[model samples]
Target: MSAAVPPVRKERNNMRARAALMSPALLIIGGFLVAPLFVVLVYSFLTPGTYGGVIWEWTTDAYVQFLFEKDIFDETLIFSTAYLQIYSRSFVQAAASTAICFLIGFPTAYFIATRPAAQRNMWVLLVTVPYWINLLIRTIAMLFLVRDNGPLNHLLLSWGIIDEPIHIAYTNFGVGIGLVYSYLPFMVLPIYATIERFDFRLVEAAFDLYADRWTVLWKIILPLCAPGVIAGSLLVFIPSLGAFIAPDLLGGGKNLMIGNLIAMQFQASRNWPFGAAAAMILMTIVLVTLIFYARRQGRSTVRLH
Candidate 1:
């Protein structure tokens, strides 16, 4: 029928218009993200070339190398635990940094969220000011401040806190401090966003019901801020796990994380396959974490509803 034909034709035109609008974004994702990930996945299965390239030959040696190293002369697989130790260390540092960020960021975000709207923007700008400078520059600045004979040590020495300059710059302590400083804004902004939308009347109600400050915060404020906290933790944890610059500069290259390992594989070791495998493993872990987090959040939402 002619009437049906017009409606069907209009529907096709609408579909075509939508497809046209989405095509650029779809192409970019496919070309950049999906293609590179596919390349890495394929590289993980291939053999490493003798001279710093892939051989295109299928092999499981990369994954095997993660846990064991082949004996140079015996041609036997020797169980090695060094990489495992590195991974464990990476996890510990990431977790500790996340905890520190949360401890510091929660109060800072709360303070910001409690400020009047006119003043809030300035406070947020201060939080984000460090981001304007290059990360490497900011990290180097930290090194300057914390290094032995640096300003912090000089100040401590002037104040007679200790007889000699303390070695805080090139240690795990320095790395932790750098990580917390670098990622603090990420932790603060998310929690601040969540708290800004929170209803203050609920706080007043809790207080009116004879709830103390601690009780209101523990029960009402934190629970309402849960989404932001989770988001910020993920943002901080994932990157901190793969942190390279802070550890390299602050940890003095003595402390190596998974990111450093990956970089070493590609650059120093000239082992593309192993690097690809490590990258894949890292991606898989992050993916699993995100999925678990998303499911937990969904369940919590359902319960809240």
Candidate 2:
């Protein structure tokens, strides 16, 4: 009689079939994601021509230009005084926006997450409904509201609080407000997803064992919800750092971001290679942040598990 086939043999056969079926996804990711990244890396090393195309000379001038070309910015002060200011300001603004969103979204998500399933869905809907409107429209609407003759100024004037309307339409504060408003929902949903399933019983137990609110939060709640915090920070911070449209429209180009500088390289300056380099540099910064966030979160999850 023929020897009976082993269960392990059959399982291996089935596993092979499953792997074969997943080939399409592997191919798709390779083509779309991997290829584009590979191409961009290649482009970053090429030399930019005067006519906007890249020359395959493998030069680092694009990078050197941005890093060392002080005289280009000396006239208006980008090199001497404002060289580092743009990035510093962007960092501060992005940090503030991330912090604000976290503060607001954490409690909001905590409250929503503890609700009944049906009620929780409704609360989420309320927060997400603003996203149905276009971002540009929202920015423009804010611009309209904060304009000198708009409702806010008119109201202030009617109240006799000031003789003239304050110029607020195109300022850093305006840009920050827009960034926070636009990205708030992004931050909220990620946090809500993780925190919604959060077991507050741990906190209650801590309190029962004589832990105070601060202690409970620091030891129990925060550690439990750190994944959500990391996710929210990545969501808000990455986009806020690269925010161009909001700052351009609301801040009126006065609050130009690194994103705007990258755009100008491509469009205004016709410097493809330099643009690619800037893109790569900005991407590197984002990747570093993401790596940090991921490592922190992975360790937290591992410790929790």
Candidate 3:
């Protein structure tokens, strides 16, 4: 009270207080996220132990093995496209799941968002009810429903839809269905949030200007909800790309994805370094894709503005 503090000193003290507040969060992120990522990077560059896990020696053999395999007799590396196919399959399945989620989710979200505010929570609860059940349990339930001689097939056969039961379980179709069912809630929630906050006045204005339903949807609704669509797509796509259980159970090991490949390295092949390298590759691919998408979205936003 005797001496007034300088403004700069006061600001510096405030900054220090803010930094102290943030320290816990920063420490948690560094310890959990950054530490694990750094460990993976280091392991990716290390040599694989004969039994399992990594050796201390640095080597690029893990990265090299991603696209090539050593011939047993000649001990020479030859280009192999098997891993490429697995990556491609993962991408296709992920894309298909995302597309299906979007198609089903958009209408569902729109319908929910249009509901009376008093009843909106109930609709959201219904959408999210599946989350209360474990994903593995849900997938197994799907297996029971789609398997040959299961209730669904038996019902269809009884209805005389076809002479024989269609093989839906343990196939790509089953995996796709499981993925869509698992991630549909993720796709719905974001889009619903966006739509619920949307200015219905603009829709009315479009209608006042004599815009048809299709035109308004294409020119206004879709554009306005684009952020939610992108968010939902990323939410659905990323997890679908790394999907393990659905593919493992539904694909029956015949249709292997990148997740399966990673599991095989760590579990079956006992090559931790290769597995880490594969994980790093998948992370890099996801990062690049996100960066490209972000840039494109930025440009689109600028154009709209």
Question: Which candidate has the highest TM-score of all?
Answer: 3
Report how far off residue 197 is in candidate 3 (Å): 0.9
**Candidate 1: tens digits of C-alpha lDDT, residues 32-58:** 999999999999989987778899799
Candidates, ranked, lDDT = 3, 1, 2
User: Model 2 reaches what TM-score against the true structure?
Assistant: 0.86
- Candidate 2, superposed: residue stretches over 4 Å from native: 1-19, 70-84, 160-164, 302-305
lDDT against the true structure, per candidate, is: 0.92, 0.83, 0.93
| Candidate 3: residue pairs that collide | none
For residues 142-257, what per-residue lDDT tens digits would candidate 2 score against the true structure? Answer: 88998788999999999999899988878888888888988998888988998888887887799899998899988888887777888888899989998888788878887678
Check candidate 2 and list the clashing pairs.
Answer: none
Residue-level lDDT of model 3, residues 120-206, one tens digit each, is 999999998989999999998898889998999999999999889999899999889989999999999999999999999999999
Single out the weakest 10-residue window by summed lDDT for candidate 1. Answer: 1-10
In terms of lDDT, model 1 sits at: 0.92
